[model samples]
Target: MRAPRDKVIITCAVTGNLTTPDQTPYLPITPQQIADSCLGAADAGAAVVHIHVRDPATGRPSMALEYYQEVVERIRAKNPELILNITTGPGGRFVPSADDPKVAAAGTTLMVPEKRVEHVTALKPDICTLDLNTMNSGKEVVINTPGNVRRMAKVIAEAGVKPEIELFDSGDIALMNDLLKDGTLKGPILCSFVMGVRYGFQPAPETVIYARNLLPPDAEFTAIGIGRAAFSSVAQSYLAGGHVRVGLEDGVYISRGKLAASNAEMVTKARRLVEDLGGEIASFAEARRIVGLAPYSATRAA
Candidate 1:
């Protein structure tokens, strides 16, 4: 039961890893307000934005490499082919010393696996997020081991860059199948199964169909849900066949506890639930050829 409009890859996530502006005033800090909310979430129906930067005067969360080279050169200076995904899960969160709970707490937590992805290997962003195994990221306890996801997937596959692999529970999808059988992840393996984050993994429909049956038949995936389970897992990840992520970086309300003014109105309400489930939304160069990405470079990206 996983095959509808065929290619549905939305993936917005314009700014996250921490919501500020006192938890939701449309949280997109500087670098031109995250490149103007990632160019209005890639013209509503985002084909892949997923960035994270902040610190426009203390909004916080910033591992500054010139604010990720000016928000990936202002979203490739206006969609020069925008499939930019950048976030090495912002270092790694690890709060400890609550009455000496084994000391280690200075706010911007753990940054080691090559300084937790040195600004995605110096802005080689066509995709970057190697947070393959680290749990309990609510208010501490996140440790991406497997020797830091095999040293940040071997420097994001020697700077060719592409490691989405962010499975949060069901054992991090067997640590991304042991980083794809230790060849250190390469192939079409892009994953994201972020359920609610209090303890991680809890958005149901059987946890998005057991994280799409622990994908390992040449995996390619996406599914984000938090805060009212993002309208039941973005229509349950398009009824479990995969692909779909939304904005305000994992929802900042759009009902019940309402408050979602923009982030291109959360990808225009996730492209009206993927055209009311008849699904058809993968643009930005067909989501860079359905996420193999390697083409959009408007004049060497400005």
Candidate 2:
């Protein structure tokens, strides 16, 4: 394992496209709620806030540009320093129809590469996710072909937003290397190992370590364990020289059978865990530098 850094970056995934309000009342739905969640997470020691917007009335995931614009504007107005990582992984889902394999089934959101990255280009966030692999995400197939990935990577890079390559399993690492070799992605890459989603890598120390070993030496990575493995993955990633991400997007529960009150609560606990391990939490500016982002300036829009 590589040597652990003295400082760790904590990212809070404020809201996700998957989970709904029914599963947990604490999930942020409206733009105001999402913005507020980001602020709370930042206050709780999270340097970066990963966001996914939802329909305020229906509480369903939305790719509407206005929703994103409003959310980003609100967060920027209140906390300009926090790094925002918007999701470009939402429209890649494809559930093929059993009756007609050529056609998409319900719950499929397959989109053109240009449309998938429209928000990133428009908003110019500090960072935007670039999912490097296509695999089964529960019942639906999350489609990210090599061509699509390259296209999205190019667009994101041209927009001046750092791409956080997201990997669900070890196989995804090969794709990451390909992107690096092709120059679609640059060095000191920021990767996130998302574990324990259905059909994805199971959350375990060995799994986390194996994935970490595949990364480029100069790359910085974070690990997130879904549901029950959330906290354990955080500890393992920290011990193995990686950063951490947590929030309602990954898991709603703070503990077994108990739902987290908010994103802030999860971040607070992450801070304590890092501290208990004798690690210092990285500030927003420090996190930007560590991830190869330019220093934040007040004149810069969030």
Candidate 3:
């Protein structure tokens, strides 16, 4: 794919599935809080808001369709133009039992493919994530087997929502290629190259460039650097001709040893980087055109 020369799309991942409130007090838990944060990020120049709902009381990641619906409704009510990208990648975790090995241990969140994409089918957002590979995302394994990925891809396609093919390492690009060739996925494809996750791909300039080279001709990609590598990855992604993502979901700190005050703060920093590097930030309408999403009104009606 050709590099986006004139505009950069900044995506803010409002709240992720793994991080708890204890880790960062600023994490948005309630649906209202998540919606507010998304509005704040958009105001601060984020073209898209990537959402993952959580249980308000405990701050645990939730797959409840109601939570997803409420969050989307709230965000849309406030800022109808901002692109919404919800996640379907949260319920695939697998932690093996210590004794049996085959049995799922406590904290395992593995679900059937249908259940994983339930929210996407119910609430048709502008975009949804489709993690392309299964790998260890810490102590637990995120099981996205090829069979399940194919199933989920079909479902998401049927729903008319664009899939952001998420990749943790260069090897996962093979699966992306397979999906593209098999007609399970279509162009212009959207991919997220997630870096610095433990046991996944490392966050580095070479790693980012390597993944960029592996993308298909019609694909548009974003690079997200988790934790300390977040800002660095943002800079590198822009330099490597891809878009950028930043928020509490990927990292808590705005800089060395400083926790980001909010998702908007991180986005503000990302916007600065994009502008300083001679690239203009894409507005919501521009992002919609770049990603090939339907109009906001049509999306809501769908």
Candidate 4:
């Protein structure tokens, strides 16, 4: 039998919470913008779009089901085969008390585990992320304790949604592994190494190597290297037997000292990297097959 082609799945995270228009003018916020960004990424060779919705009016993070519905509807209207990976990760940010260390003031958005997965259950996305670590994420602390991870895992498993176990460092892989052994995570595993964010995993070949080594063999892994570590880490990830993630969510720049005009540009660059290294890009159907995600027959576009 002839050997199958090595296919690299390109995932584009459309919009994020932390970045603002002041930082980058092209970051998508509204449903139309997010959907457009996904379409652009698809045309640029991306097989998946990982989404986090924002308030259409203020551009702040939103958990409203309608917002997610709009984004999904718009994307599916164009292509039902494109994979949609929603984020259940926004509600976990904890910016501890600025004045007193004892009392947590505002700036935190921690929710009960069930509350966090509400959108996942309602949206029934192809895949969704369940961040598995509690880390000092910049000025804020992003938390996902054992109890919450277990709770959310059950909810995701019951909803028949693939949880993309998001980790920031090597220890996180071990922690997620522990959950599997404990029977908390009960479906096919997908991992994404979020690198270069301050106070998170530093982006480098060695760090990626260690992190990748810690993942379960049954796991399918990808990388998102933010800020200055973007392209270099993606290159390293492909070199290390993994896929790459790109978009306004990960980095605002197309190159050092230059800004990216859109998420499509990011996907285009990622495609170039995979091809230059002799790896083929996965189509939407192929990506679903590789990631073990069942297609959502619930498409409104259908």
Highest lDDT: give the candidate number: 2
Q: 1-302, model 1: which lDDT tens digit per residue? A: 46654668787787786666776887888989888888887887777888888878987777788987988887776676778888887667778877886788766377678877877778888888777656666567778788777877888888888888888888888877877877888766888888888887888878888777878755778778977888678888887778888887687887777788778887888788878888888777777877687666656666
Stretches of candidate 3 off by over 4 Å are 1-4, 298-302
Candidate 4 residue 127 C-alpha distance from true site, Å = 0.2
Tell me the tens digit of each residue's lDDT in model 3 across 68-122. 8999998887788999999998778889999998999999888889889989999
Tell me the tens digit of each residue's lDDT in model 4 across 247-299.
Answer: 88888999888999999999998889889889899988789889886644654
Top candidate (TM-score) = 2
Candidate 1 accuracy as TM-score: 0.31
Using lDDT as the measure, name the better of candidate 1 and candidate 2.
Answer: 2
lDDT of 2 by residue, 61-99 (tens): 999999999999998888898999999988898888999
TM-score of 3: 0.97
What total of clashing residue pairs does each candidate reach? Answer: 0, 0, 0, 0
- Overall local distance difference test of candidate 1: 0.79
In model 3, what lDDT does residue 282 have? 93
Clashing pairs in 3: none
Better of 2 and 3 by lDDT: 2
